[model samples]
Target: MLRTRIITALILAPIVIGILIYAPKPLMGLFFLLCATACLLETLSFMLPAFENRLAGKHVDTIVTKASGETHTKIFAPETRRPMLITVGLAWCMFLLMIFGGAEGAFGSLVAGILATIMVGCFLADDVQLGAARSISMVFSLAYSVLPWVAVWQIYLMAPHSRYILLVVIIVWCGDTGGYFGGRMLGGKVFGDRKLAPKISPKKTWEGAVCGLLLSIVV
Candidate 1:
């Protein structure tokens, strides 16, 4: 797994650097937008596996309209993929709209509006199959994966010529590397023998976290 991660990083680093340093603002924003969409899909799938399934067919039986034109249903398979796609689509639409709607001065408001749109989408997608828990997870995961990228874009727009963006990226990568190596080397030692969140992530350790922090500071 570590080797795979390293390889992936090696392959992506140059492309990401090129984009961050040389690409135009619109291109950079678009690249991160695509990444955010992929992250949203992956996070939703992790929370609800059915979300990743291809849309085989839309079963009309899933919803039935009555004479009063009211749709009613008691139990039905979740329209996971469709609803998730729609929700994500709505979020991105709002994101783009905000980006073009006075980004020069209202960056924070634009981000808030985009995030609000995503939250609304999550609530609207809540249903029997896509329970509230899963819906909330989707919202959190989207925020987790997308917000940092948005911040990077914001920094770029705010400081187009500054190398601080590159510095931040380097620090993040250094921290990740330090944590991985530190955990492997020190996590099982009697002196520092413990996991950080054993129930959630058996491989994480306080030692690793400290190493990460130190490395980030040094970088």
Candidate 2:
């Protein structure tokens, strides 16, 4: 899998870079939309694996694709894929509409919609803790997918000629890359659920974070 991933990256990275540099808007939109769609769908699948399962009811396992007696737990199963694709499509359509509507309208609507969706997800969760976790996941999902998207779009729109975009990117990029490798190599780690707060940031360690921070500075 790693080998395939590397080969695919090697093959496509230059073409993608070319598109980012030369094609700009069209490529960015296409890539962002694809990424957004895939990520959202994967998340929904992971979050709600029984999306198709419950609907199948008593005959759930008997509903096989072909000769098989059992339903395949494929990632891109027909039932799961359709909803995700549809949701992302509608979201992107709204995003495009917002683009024509003005920045305040666009960003405001985007963020609002995201927050509202997360809130809804939170409400649907089992309890307060689950709701909070779902909310956090949704928020992080939006930020991870949307922030870079907004930044890239804005960079193309606002600073087409400015060299400073690369400068800022390089600094952050170098820092992140350096921090990742440094932490893995240098940071002393304890295995299992060693708790610091045992309440907040429980999974985190004092060691790895410090190493990452120092590595970022050095880089």
Candidate 3:
């Protein structure tokens, strides 16, 4: 697993670096837009699996109640994936586009767009069992996994803050490396045999966390 992670990182590192260093503003914005879209989709898969299945065109079993107080079973067909992606993905893209266009009211327009999208999603949900979960996930996914990428893009556009953004990235990389190595070296041996949060992450250790914090500070 470790070897696979390293190999994957080696393959992706150059592509990420090249985009960060050489891509023009528009291309850079596009890169983050794609990243945010992928993250949003992945988050939805975990937070609202039913919604993901629906988007993938799977027929979902649902029950309906008629006015006569009788219930019937039904299989609801899925919607087109591409159209949904394009529709929802455009919200993030529009925000990036507005930043690139340097509009004075970009933030306001983005907020309005987000609100309108959320409202539409909530109103259109037909399955009561999954509707609230999916609707809440839609809003949370945008704020959690999507907006941070948009913030990074905004930071990159600022010539002065761009270097600081790179520094932050380097710091995070250093912390990750420190944590992995430190845990391997001192975790089970020197830091007592007990595991930190054994139910969650069996490999994490207090010593490793401290080492990561120190490395990040040094970076």
Clashes of each: 0, 0, 0
TM-score of each: 0.66, 0.52, 0.71
lDDT of 3 by residue, 1-219 (tens): 689769977998777666577777667777777787777665554444455355533344444456444322232224423323533565566566566656466677667656765665656566553445455556666677777776786678777425756776888878888888888778877668777787667679877887888999987
Estimate, for each residue in 30-107, the C-alpha lDDT of model 2 and write its tens digit.
776666656665555443344323422211122356743434434455533543444455456545645456566777
**Candidate 3 least-lDDT 10 residues:** 71-80
> What lDDT score belongs to each candidate, Candidate 1 first?
0.63, 0.52, 0.64
Where does candidate 3 clash, by residue pair? none
Candidate 1 C-alpha error for residue 60, in Å: 18
lDDT value for candidate 3? 0.64
Rank by lDDT, highest first: 3, 1, 2
Span of ten consecutive residues with least summed lDDT in model 2: 53-62
Report RMSD for candidate 3.
Answer: 8.9
| lDDT, candidate 1, 1-219, per-residue tens | 888998999999988788777888787768778877777665554544323222222232234456445433222235455545655775576457646664553466546645665555456543433444445555665566666666666666667642778888899999999899887787767346567897667779888888889999987
Stronger candidate by TM-score (1 vs 2) = 1
Candidate 1 least-lDDT 10 residues: 52-61
